[model samples]
Target: MTGVSFHEFRITDSQRLDFHYEIDSETEKKTGEIHFQSNIPIPFDPDSVALALSTMCGSAYRRVRMDLRVSPRARKVVESFLRCELSAPARGGVTPERRRRGNVLSFSGGFDSLAALRLMPDDTNLVSMDFGGRFSTEKPFFDKFRPTVISTNIVGTDFQRNSWSFMGIGAILTAPIHAAKYMTFGSILEAGVDNLRRLPLTSRGQTFPPFAGAGYRNAPYVAGITEIGTAMILVTYCPEVVNDSLASLALPGEEKLYRKYVLASIAAERAGLTVDLKEPPPPATRRPFGRNFTADFLSLYIRRFGGAQVRDAFLTDVPAEIDALSERLALTFYERINTTIMQKFPVELAGGLYERAAVAGLVPYTEDDWREYMIVRDALAPYHPTVAR
Candidate 1:
């Protein structure tokens, strides 16, 4: 049943990040360095939070060496910005900020998240989200966190597709169904935009406005006192290999491969930007290439493409010499896919089987329905990465 363990993991994405850690002195705060070289061009201020994520995601980084510094200004800004809450309480209620910071690396309670947790600083508040569909994979991980796992929920509340009919979003290969990060229009979108506005962009300067009316559309979701209760955070997702905490379930390698090279890869890069990014090839045209491709294809087609763009307080760029530091910033997803699957796809049960395909290179370059993606894509422009926007 098992050769190597498939540990599932969860990654809370942020178009930008501002890690407001406690600092000892002045010089310590200003001097921070990310030693990763990557093909992707990174652009942001050194004191910005996106640095933490940039160093890990695309850049194949091993160690994040930084001289811990505290920016009273940046800290106050990020804390006040991200420290808001989202909860449902009626009338007078005593709701306290969740105490344990479940800074789980890979949410499987097995490998990645656990690694992050092991190294997490004391007093860090642990916050967890519950994907109604991903209970099993998510629950075990919570159990691992024991009492520290603070819970929340997410659902695909709505959607709208773009052009597959004419030359709208997709090409001739366009189908009625497609999933790109920008394909959906509600729930996740509303929640995400609200979260972004509450955060600070500069050194406590700009209010970080929504571009293209993003804030206006999702304003309803952030109404009232629910805004003052809980804050959804972006935790660091480090790569770890925990053999003991792996699930037996996994799609085959060949099936996964097809989804990867063809379906997923195209969808993520191509479909997101170009709509209807799939090739002219039919589903039955090829044998399941590998678990990677089949798994990715099935998941993408299933949701039709929601939950692909799970970016809320996403970190933008922080001036990284990525092109030259290619090796430093270059991440090796060669094994992360299998590891995530083995771990049961933490965030969404569908994630293990579905969305993880979106993040990993499986869905490399695909398109969205021009009609559908635009409806939400433009609305989400405010929350997108600086580079992406």
Candidate 2:
């Protein structure tokens, strides 16, 4: 009674269902709805639905003991996540196992996600959540991949915020529908190590445990690559998509910075430098891009190509370096992927997946591929910030 209580979800229509929940002793309950595409009914499993609801809004509660009907496995997953994230002892009870196969990616048609899509199996189901009308423009873009678009207004509510748990909600909710045993996200290296300060990619406090307990393997397909690498891959493989779609999807001030980084990655690769997974030494002082988790990357770039030139090209301040370090200090995209794939997938399957990606040309960097890069760079350069003379 003193914690969050999840009541049954009411099916509003064929494409919509509303979940009602209450805060500690609150008389009036808050309602959240999950809207599928036209004619796709909500999954009938109460346990899965409860897990999805807890993932969407459980953090809004101060105390974390969520009372809901869930299977033992699902309850364990929820309790573990709650304990780790909110430090609350969550309680819940039973649902049948659904046979599942293949993978489902939480696609957003962004640079990082496109990189993930490229690395995933050919049959991996692409699922994107449209936040009301925020992502309406991407619908046509998402169609290129033939993704299942699920529009939901959950993001419009106060509970919506960036969290590891929040990132995979779409894939989790839609995985059962697609019979996908693996839930993949476009989470990149910068997100886990640079932003959250976690390593090994499978650190316990992240989204892996709960996803595993729910019988869905958590696969961070792009976890090995940095945002810079993602941009490079996109430019090499799909410059048109990046120019026509992803560029427009970026926030007002971010597009230029992203382009600069993509250009920097291209230059680095041409110079035969690759990303070193060895964590860079912490900055001597906080930098402007520190809050964005890209300060380390900037430092890496500075080291790769003299600080003065990088600063001038990117039109951003660079941090002072204590000493010149080798690119070996950072994790190459390939090494990171090899480590990550084995952990997230069966070892037998991991090798084949890696091979498939390699055959599909999802390697470290597009070293020799400058034709598309040059076109993309020139086309987007006008928008990039010009360095003061």
Global lDDT scores for all candidate models: 0.23, 0.52
- By summed lDDT, the worst window of 10 consecutive residues in model 2 runs over 380-389
Instruction: Output the lDDT of residue 75, model 1.
Output: 31
| lDDT, candidate 2, 150-172, per-residue tens | 66666655446523465555666
Backbone clashes, each candidate? 101, 6
lDDT of 2 at 129: 72
Clashing pairs in 2: 70-93, 276-330, 276-331, 277-330, 277-331, 278-330
Candidate number of the best lDDT: 2
lDDT of 1: 0.23
